[model samples]
Target: MNPSHPATASRHTATKTILFVVLAVALLVSVLVSAGTGQLGIPPQEVLGSLLHRVGIDWLPLPTHPTGDQTLWAIRFPRVAMAALVGAGLAVAGLIMQAIFGNPLAEPGVIGISSGAAVGAGLAIVFGLTVFGEWTTAVFAFVAGLAATLIVYAMSRAEGKTEVVTLVLTGIAVNAIAGAAIALLTFLGDTQSREQIVFWQLGSLAGSRWSQVLIVAPVIAIGLIVAYAVARKLDLLSLGERNARHLGVNVEALRIGMIFIVALLTGAAVAFAGIIAFVGLVIPHLMRMILGPAHLPLVTASALGGALLLTLADLGARTIVPMADMPIGMLTALVGGPFFFWLLRRTRKRAGGWG
Candidate 1:
């Protein structure tokens, strides 16, 4: 139950505000730390100097030597930024999913959106299609994501109502179908295309560049803004759609709009990062546990928390093995999958309704 006393609510709000501030600092620190820890071992000071210089902070001293400066600029910087953006996008998408479904466990992967995106990307690779020119991957991903969500919505809605149980079931079914399609594409692909499909499925940031960062970062920002604007409606809908309607919220339209936003953000993230797992599932819950359940604070906290989680995870992926690069997505799953299992075990007795 929500705390009703004004003093209690204010206290909770204060705590959330502090969390937001701390998370922001942590994200900055993580990015800087990640920038220094890559191959060639750029010194922290040089990383900072190089980054500031590149960003037009002319007052900052330039690095004395070029080796660490090049490492920071050409390699580590792009990877860290990509990880952070992908993390923030997935986290925002997860928050929206949980809000719309009123279920804390609802995430893109659980509901098949990620799998659908992978299938789309996989097919694009297999067929050598690039219809959107330079942005073809992102475009195809958005289409596949939208299609998957629509299929879930149609299957779950009947008599002008959505059944949460049916939605979960339908998502599982769709995810399985999409997985089969991905497998088929992989089998039919030639050796080169097959390697591309494999890497995309595993999810790596090996070849991250500034251009890919630019392509995805805008979509993430726009989607989060849309989600934030409807934050109150999401809170209302959580109380139940009938109550939301009574309170002057347009439940159907809001739900549809939120779903589309989720698709757009999730699609963009997957398109660029290639099926990173559990980011959406883990980050929002951590944020909510720190902040209260209020949508505004929850969403805000989740965005930062997600960015931090992904950025840190990427750092580990790079640093954990000296000679080899690990898939950032795999790192997330390695960490998030165990947490997910524990969450399910902890909540099994309650069996809360799906959001």
Candidate 2:
């Protein structure tokens, strides 16, 4: 078989299509399972029925258990949906950041955006700020996240271009400042507020509400759409800047647009769920490894992979302790930390020394 033959290309395309279908099915299954796993133990069938009923598909039989519909609709479904949104958003944001920086290790949480949002959330919690009433924390978090990204970009830009090393270093400095701000807020807060700050930092979807989901979903959906529209440009960008420019990509504009989208997606995710880590870093990298570096498939695969990961992680968070909800962030960090170490070691070996 000729490796470059048209038949070989067709077969490869067929394989990728099948992989995408499998991943989509897995994500759907994860959602159903996650929605069914709370204290009441709603079966997947009942969960599906409840969802169908809510969407006006009244032909399907309703849940037999008296409280099943209410529990699924009012509680479990919202949490599961939010988890999917946050997971997808974070993963896609990570993919964009990595593309923009041309580094596999780039991630929102690692690059100070999550910390910046955390600082804003801390302020809202400690000071009892109610500028946006119930959404004060979310608004503050979103704005602060964008602010941090802008600061990083401005600091990193030089001679009409943004260097990858400069951006990474700026992220490190911004993260340190954001961390210090959060710590100071924690110190000044009352016991209740301090606890709230701590728990929020650790990240959980415990209080996931339909209202919050409503706000987060649209933002993430829009960001994902924008990302997909530019997927080809991102692929061109993976080539060096000069080559990309020669190919007619407006490199500076693409970077700025991607940065903005990353801010919007990452901010929305953090605002609702706090700082869940590793979904972004791990999912995209894994997807890239399996599907190759084509941004379109990589982005789609990363979204599904992230959604599946978080839904499963949330299930583990709820069920692992048998009655207590564990911190979702802790679980992701536990998984991601080792993976991160391995990634660093591999990259170092590949480069033959740290840059």
Candidate 3:
């Protein structure tokens, strides 16, 4: 018997709409608030005026100094925007990967896509491949991530069906191999290249620019829409492969499409921001805990929550010490690692009937 009834469906829909609105407002406030923060400590009114001035609000007085105005317009805005985009993209990618593989534990980091992107970025740094303008590293990173996902998909396929456990195991193996490849690349890199590679590995949004935001924003938007479009199908997919196929879903096609989109989003995020882990794993699971397993709500909640979490984390990264910017990745891992272990313990307890 289906657990979903008409009342439950209506309630779920209502909850989702409310969550979306709340998150939308929250995101707007976060953007404005985060923009005003940093070492310079621009006043909120000034931040608003500068932002409005940029968009043709001539009546409002602008920041008189070029340095302050440029700091807000050029430096802070792009970093916050990139952080939001990367967080949303990685979270959605994780949701898609989990749905496609039918494993709650599956994530871009777990399956090696982030590592692949890092390798791609490292290769570009080491070799100076600049055929594609400023996007040389990004393009290669996307390609490598896509390739890694496809290889894992192929390896996990057996007798024309995907085994979720096998897929996860395949990811572990691929991730290890990708890790080695990255290490090897680092070993062979020159000192200058090695420093660049180290920074990329550690992950920071401190130097993000408008150009990087422009490159990543569109792709992530497209990927998010595609993922949401299939949200209902992903809900059905949670039932079982046989059940999903019986319900008129194209299982194989769905899996492949999800892998592709997730790879694109994950690769683009890693390209611009480097490998930040557990946003995907932690946020989606938190959403699930609060809102249940409906994909529509889950995806939107994950996006908003992930964006908020990363923005806050980035803020901490910048302000945690005076004049010392810590790696954003380190901050995320510091929090996400313990959370993940707690989740594992909780799962084990529940499974053992001790919850």
TM-score of each: 0.92, 0.93, 0.89
lDDT score for candidate 1 against the true structure? 0.83
Q: What is candidate 2's lDDT per residue for 156-211, written digit by digit as tens?
A: 77775666567768888998998789889989999999988887689999989899
RMSD of each: 2.7, 2.3, 3.3
Which pairs of residues have clashing backbones in candidate 1? 101-355, 102-355, 103-355
Q: List the residue pairs that clash in candidate 2.
A: none
Instruction: For candidate 1, report its TM-score.
Output: 0.92
Off by over 4 Å in 1: 1-6, 55-61, 157-165, 351-355
Model 3 per-residue lDDT tens digits across residues 1-355:
5677878888877877887788778777777778878777777667778888878887656665567788887899999999999999999998888788765667788777888888898899899899898989988898899899888878877786666557667878987888888888889999998887887678889899999999999988998899789999999998988999999999989988898898899889999888898888888887787788779878889989888888888888888897888899888889888886787577556567422
Candidate 2 regions with alpha-carbon error over 4 angstroms: 1-3, 56-61, 154-170
Give candidate 2's whole-model lDDT. Answer: 0.87
Which residue pairs of candidate 3 clash? none
Whole-model lDDT per candidate = 0.83, 0.87, 0.84
| Best-matching candidate per lDDT | 2
